[model samples]
Target: MTDATTTTAEAETAARPWLDASLPVAERVELLLAEMTVEEKAGLLFQTMITMGEDGELAEADPVFGLPSNREFVLEKGMTHFNLLGVAPTAGAIARWHNKLQELAASTRLGIPVTISTDPRHSFTENPGAAMLAGPFSQWPDALGLAATRDAALVERFGDIARQEYTAVGIRVALHPQVDLATEPRWSRVLQTFGEDAELSGELGAAYIRGFQNGDAFGAESVSTMVKHFPGGGPQKDGEDPHFAYGREQVYPGGQFELHLKPFAAAFDAGVRQVMPYYGMPVDTEYEEVGFGFNKSVLTGLLRERFEFDGIVCTDWGLVNDAAIFGQPFPARAWGVEHLTPLERVEKILDAGADQFGGEACPELVLELVAQGRVDEQRLDVSVRRLLREKFALGLFENPFVDAEAADAIVGSAEFRAAGDAAQRASIAVLSNRDAVLPFTPGVKLYVEGIAPEVAAAYGEVVDSPADADLAVLRLQAPFEQRATMFENFFHAGSLEFSGDVVAHVAEVAAAVPTVVDVFLDRPAILGPVVEAASAVAGNWGASAAALLDVLSGAAPAGGRLPFDIPSSMAAVEASRPDVPFDTADPLFRFGHGLTL
Candidate 1:
């Protein structure tokens, strides 16, 4: 161990006496608050990931940066609150790293334990394309799948399981329970959100918060839930996402923006501690024409004033410049306010009443803003006070260390795995079964395509491909953002029309056998041809694929309604007003429209 680690361990051991709960909460908070410096308090607001190097050790950097490197600078300068990055190979290693970091924080006069936060990690597929992998955490289905099951109890159970896994690894804050309704199917981030229904989404979202925080009322292990995208993030223009430059506008023609806010209201009522504004700019609303990260009218006026929310507000990533990843320099999120410099953006973010700057690793800009007297020190003090109070409320000061031995025992345990499987089974939706084409009788040779071979074999003799199947099972995906020459940025500028060859292939398979089509409606695509050719059609948001299969096999019943209208064509999507989502002149499938046995 390094000198910093040794010193920190000694300090942690020594400071245990002062962490007693017998003291009043105010007294403890006051004592801890008095010990922190401006620099140290500022450090608490900045979170960065600590990555493991290629040689299997923590990478070193300049301590002046207060990141993972520059060990001496970190110890001397006193930075706390790290977003533990890159999963470790073993729980023991994670525990060790966390303990060492806490020890370092404790060595400082205030000894405020670093409160580590994490995005969702316990999902079945790690979603490397979107979120971090579940290498060390317990694996569960994605949020869309959780929403499909329509079971509030299951949602809570999943939260409870994730809380156990997170707490075991010393992650006190969960930066999730996205709560945003997936109204716009084409949004790349839809897989992470709950389905498009406002009421159902709100109830389930609240249950998620309650589960993570638990009813402990005053326990340290109770995870702090960060309900995100304050108002909502479901009304992207033309089914485009906010991540890209062109897709930054969120429209609201159907008056569905208010519907989207319902779930967030539910999250707030549940006592969630943090709120994250989306990167999308709302064009139709009275709020500023910029993304919610920079819009004070939305963040301060609407979320804080109207909703009466009093939680910490953090901006989405890429809001400020000065950090580079992969050799590419990212600009500050000056989405609507194009003229603001990086420093100006920081001032605006603070003035808009946001508490923390997310996706930003550099704190020098913040420090510079403070030093220049551009941002009031009292403003910083208010946010820091709330942050520290949350840490105490989470019991981080009392028990900063995690029980390493319990880590493996709880993560992916048989019980948790069983719950995940049950959730998966429940979430699948069976949309259509014309003429009772489903529940194939036993001994019938079944021909399947596009589904996993293992999954297909469960039904009957699985065929080699579409041509040889007794019943053609075609799996489909919603139209994705297309790239030019496989090198350009994926911009949403394409039609939902499938390639002629793809349509031809499906038609050919339909001609050869009785066909059943299943679409993973991550986005609502024009399915006129498939719906015309196939004997039956099924559609679902995220995890509905497996559920549809189960329903077809008579293992389960189909019971999901379309959360948003399936537009008849791309023309309808483009011609519709920019503000309202699912506001097409005419829809192929209306919202809440579904079929069953």
Candidate 2:
């Protein structure tokens, strides 16, 4: 090494001290924080949804969510963080799009690289707000199915695999492993949770964090996890979601507030990097009645002081402002503080000690608060420090671009897909197998509903009708009453009991021939009538037709236990408290009930 080259490198390091990898993370964060202007600092406080453009180009606009162009979000808003909404047709396309975004950020004054995050993209659930279907990614079962397997090691392995896939496409953060206990069987988001048990959720949640964060440390290879809906988002009143206005109240009728905090405690133990509080306001609790995002008693007192957590706390989407989604306009989820204006809501959220606003792109509000002397610049720096430190710890400042050519080979590779397929098969819970009705003999005539003919033919002959077949196989989804709004309909929140029409149809098919029924148990369904009608009944979270057939044909073991109790009737569900687990009397299938067949 020549002295001239060494001197030039040293001078370059002095020009951008934050770029020097040898410095401590804290020192790097402070150095970057000092260099950022107020607009850039304000941008760090808002992380909203960003979409990919056509042909891996920069998106000019998004009419669906009314989001501005990527250029405006980066240049005008001075933003460097985003929650990637959708994926491209191919992994390489997504990687190219990510690189284009980084190139735009590089053109900025400070050149702070963008940090990309995403919701659970390896699942079948397509609730745009929650999870996306595994398009061009490895397909796996929902979180509830992972709980049914009761294998922390398997869960951890899934996380590690997911981390690798996410990083390949330039995603630095994972917005999931929703650890909320599914105490309320009727709740719409139950499928995303671990289960109704605190200890089990805590154990699995910690393992998930370990897998994503690369074994309890955040580094270049790690994908930072934002363990969320903190203080628990389950136990909604009447099993409705907090996403809509009618479902805003989160009741603790059983007075079990502390129990809901168990999984988050496990998350904290596993060294989670970020937290997102739910939109529901507490009812009859010691804390304020306002939403968790604006509740200082819970965010500051409980999380910060009592738990001594110093991670970045981000609010759930659309707390301070609301906009049109799916062509329908929605109001802000202010909950108990609905009377306050958007500006006032911002003030309360910042005062509550939240670091960022999820699903919001408004840094101008923070600028307004700063100019009016309502918010101290020093207060903003506290969160800016944490936010910048994460970008440094993630190694985003050094190399934000992914190798676009390598993404296609790495993501959804044959090995990774096989692991996901095995998980899908293992997660199928055989709730009932009367007289060894399963292990269906090969070449038996079979009538199928949801199973595609080509996939079913591998196990048995596929018949068009149940009457012409030797046996019948039906795939059904758990029942949920339809809501008025299009967005609300996605949330499957209503009666767990099967409707009269569905029960009669199942009985008709079973009466025609010996039947095997598989119900997609997003929520715990009342399966008593179906159990009586069918020769065999199974529960699956998310599995392909081939995976389900493999378990039924004795090729693979039915390796899942029930993640939550299935109520006997709607009356039992109505009688049980929302916050109490296993409170329903004489549940048809108790938690952990599954057959070995």
Name the candidate that leads on TM-score: 2
TM-score for all predictions?
0.87, 0.98
Model 1 CA deviation exceeding 4 Å by range: 1-18, 52-79, 84-96, 124-130, 136-139, 216-218, 253-257, 322-327, 442-446, 465-467, 484-494, 540-549, 578-582
Clashing pairs counted in every model: 15, 0
On residues 2-72, what C-alpha lDDT tens digit does candidate 2 reach at each position? 99998997886788899899999999988888898898999989999998898788898888778899999
- RMSD of each predicted structure: 4.5, 1.4
Q: Tell me how far the alpha carbon of residue 91 in candidate 2 is from the true structure, in angstroms, after superposition.
A: 0.8
Rate residue 526 of model 2 by lDDT: 89
